[model samples]
Target: MKSIRKYMNLPGSLFLVTLIFAMSMTPVSASAAALRADIVQCDPNPAEIGQYVNVWIKIENIGNTRAEDVSVELIPSYPFSLDTGDDTVRNIGILSTDRHASLEYNLHVDENARPGTRSIKVRYQDDEGTAWNEETLNIWVGSGSDTFDSKGTIQLEQITIEPEVLMPGDTGTVTFTLKNTATQYSISLGGEEYDTNARIRSATLEGTDDITVKSDPYHDTGILGPGDNVELTYNIEVDDTARDGTKHLEFIVVGSSYTYNYKWDVPVKVDSAGIKVIPTKPLTIDNGVATIQFDIVNTNPNTLTSVSIRPQAEGIEFSPVEYFIGSMEPDELFTAEFDAQVVSDNISNQQELALIAQYRNGINQHETFLNDLSLTIVTEKPNSGTGLASISILLIIFVISSLVMYRHKKHQQ
Candidate 1:
């Protein structure tokens, strides 16, 4: 009895042990908050002394959980001070995981500040009453004694649009060649010598409702010396329902800062024309089969490649499943022929056939649909000439037999 009681308690002990083990293995959520601060923008970068400068700092939370009671503080040191009547600390209620917040601060540069790079302190707190995390960010201060200045001008030297012309629902690339048109490395402006190197801070292609830009904006394009050029390409797509004619996109190139920016209207031509399939002969199926012919015309202003046509209709069979036309030039025409037959008797007297035209504009594949076409199915009719000929033959044979009987009777008499 003692051994049996011990065995019975062993099962309960194992179950209790398992319960404790499971409780220990269960995961617990941790309270972790990772935050980072960076200075995103400085108005009039290379800010001049004796003036107020606007600074923008971005704080991001890159942790698994939300950062509660987020706040940021700006600490200005020598050569920089907070603008009069401005607070140093900003309150940002909460920042979720992978989310960010932007803070703007106004600072006054001391009149005696020298032309050089200076560091400023920024502190952020994720939780209330928690230790503040600090970061040092640098800003450039410019003065008359600056060694280099962006004295050159940037121009759009060339614009290349792939396929030359775009059709509705097509995607292509627009490449821009930006050039610093200055002649010498240094130039004199108002008795001041400045370097002619042009720095492309950012380049972006703006799109409208009809066109969509698929490429990201280009930033920090480096320095382009006098007469140097760089090519930047952007992928764009045209809306399927876009109207015909020329569409303009605004291409902006910023040099050095916001004050030195170039904006140009880049025009792209959109032609809504495509392959047109028209029946050249009567669309009639006589005696269960017929030959159908269609004229494939390239109505587009540009050449199209890999041209092919396929006809489809319910309860109707088409031979040579698809007709292939290698390439077509502008306004070119080609005739395609197909043998069609009625495979189902339930089809109506006339059946609608879809002529799907597939082609490629440059490297982009396109499809044109022609659904208004129809095929007339004509049933076979019996011939009346066969019975008329049989009656004629019978009459001739009767006349011959009568003549033979008359001759035999005459001989017997």
Candidate 2:
């Protein structure tokens, strides 16, 4: 009976040992929670100075237990400020194991922020105020070296000119359109849309020596809201001495905070108020007859009225002494022809043909005359058929005269 009791006691002892081992293996809930925080994304990466940036922070419960009443806070460093007026601490109700929660915040970078990578600190804790995790988010700020600010707040949209083509000594207007291209959006921290002003405090025009600003060169444009545009007009005068070429003009947009310089070329053309006379065919004299042909070109921008030409030559007679051209527009070409007979015995090989052109300049209908225009006349040999015919007629006239003389002599004898 004693041996049987010992075996039973051994079995009970083994059972207790097994029970204790199973209990030890079971997991027990702990008072503290295991949390991990990471900054996953930053919108408008490489943020611009003096601009707002959105940062997204992610929190995950890596441990087996759940995190209760979690809160997140942002600690800004130098050149980085909290734009969102709300408290830094954000309340997150609960987080389960292997689960994550995201929080967003808006931060502003100072205008004088140095370029390069910077850091901001984020702290998270539980309801009991026990510290959970602290992490750093790296941010990059622009150096503001580009023409446009990093935020793209202000831009030069379009430039227009009155009388697209410019002439010497002409006065015109130049219009510049400045637009506020900044985008407005609601901030999670502030619970309102961001507000910023795009102000073009002043503007000036710069050009070469040929171009001058007639009126006030400077202008003041008040503050502009998002998507708002303002037009700045300037009166400019082109010098009379300006050549017929392209000239560069600079439009400078100046603000109390920034400056932008833009350049454009203006084309200048010659005035069209003159005429050009050119010879189309050479003047020739054959068999005591002169043929003259020439062209008259209207070079003026305006139309010429009552155009007439008078041809005069010493020791010469012309079939049509004058020619009347009704009207001639700009760049129009009119041809004039004349036939003249030589009347003088002594004639030089080259003869001068005098021509006087009269026309209305279109300003007041006043007749303007271009006089004493001379042309050289060259002597040319007659064609074979005409030369032979003239020689036969001369011979016939001489023979008839000789026969008449012979008959008269015989009668006298």
Candidate 3:
């Protein structure tokens, strides 16, 4: 009885240990409101003392569930505080998953604020039962006096868009080369020497209805001394139904102070037209064989590469399989030919033959199908000997008519 009682207790102990181990192996759960905040736009990154600075913070809900009762509170520390009559917290209704909203805050710099980086606190709250989340943001404070101003100015030296022109439903990049136009490393203003350094706080490319920007905004790009230059590129996607015309994108660049901010309208062209395939000859099969010809035309406003045509049918065989046209310029046309043979007579000779034209537009491969084209199959004509016999009979009749005319003349004489 004692041994049996001990065995029963042993099974209970084992069960208890197993339960504890399983509980320890379980993973922790994450919050439903996965909120993230970023300072996308700061008009004047280096705030001037005794002046107001406009800050735009982008709040994004990265979680799968919607975040309700979203509120952003600006908690500025020393040297930075919300201006008078400005609310410290802004209540934004709801933020759906993967969606973002921008909150603007007006901050006033203290009269005695030192010229350097300062910290500010941002608090956001959602209805996830977890009260609030906080983030710290750093901003630059400029010297209030103009004697120590930034002498260099940033200019957009060049703009380049890949493929130059974008086709609808295409993804491309737009690059901008920014240069500090100051010639000297330092400049004297009001008998005071200041360094010709341009601090690039942020650069943002705003998209329109027809375009969607995929690249993140540039932040704290550091300093550009004198004539130094830097390049910024943004990835963009054109909508498939975008109209064919010139679309404008807003390019915004903020410098040392709000006074140095720059905005420009960058033009992007969209063309939805593509390559065309036209049959240059009658699509017919004679004697169970046919020579198919097509004129491949690049109707797009840009050049296309790797131009090729492939002919396919249910019971037909094509010579060369596919015709390759190396490259085609805008509005250029190239004729391609293929020898087709009817392998199966049962195949409806009058069926539509498929003409697939494949080409590349600015590194994007596209295919156009011409499947509604009708093809006719005509039986071979009668033997050549029959045609020869008909010609012989005509010649014999002509000769006999000439002899009869000659005999009639002799009888008359």
lDDT of 3 at 70: 87
- Candidate 2 regions exceeding 4 Å error are 1-152, 162-168, 182-193, 243-245, 259-413
Sort by lDDT, best first.
Answer: 1, 3, 2
Per-residue lDDT tens digits of candidate 3, residues 245-289? 999988999787667889988999998777788998999998889
**Per-residue CA lDDT of candidate 2, range 1-413, in tens?**
99999998998999999999877764344334677776544544556688887777777776777888888888989778886575788889788665667888788889888888899998887555564568887776656552233222567787776634455666767787878776662122345444455655346665455666655545446767777788878887666677766667666554434333333343433352455666677666676876777798877665667887777778787768888886888789999888878888877766666677766642223333454445454566657998899999999999999999999999999
* Clash tally, candidates in order: 0, 3, 0
User: What TM-score would you give candidate 1 relative to the actual structure?
Assistant: 0.63
Residue 321, candidate 2: C-alpha displacement in angstroms? 15
Candidate 1 C-alpha lDDT tens digits along 1-413: 99999998998999999998877664222237788887656665667788878887878876777888998989999799986678888899888775677788888889999888898999988878877889999987878553236878898999999988999889999999999999998978799988888888768787766787789878788999999999999999998888999999888776764467677999999998889988999999987899999999999998999999999999989988999998999999999999998889799888999999999997889987889988888897899999999999999999999999999999999
**Would you give me the overall lDDT of model 2?**
0.67
Candidate 2: the clashing residue pairs are 272-300, 272-301, 273-300
Where does the lowest 10-residue lDDT sum fall in candidate 1? 24-33
Winner on TM-score (2 vs 3): 3
Candidate 3: stretches off by over 4 Å: 1-37, 58-103, 109-148, 184-188, 193-199, 219-227, 239-243, 380-413
* Index of the highest-TM-score prediction: 3
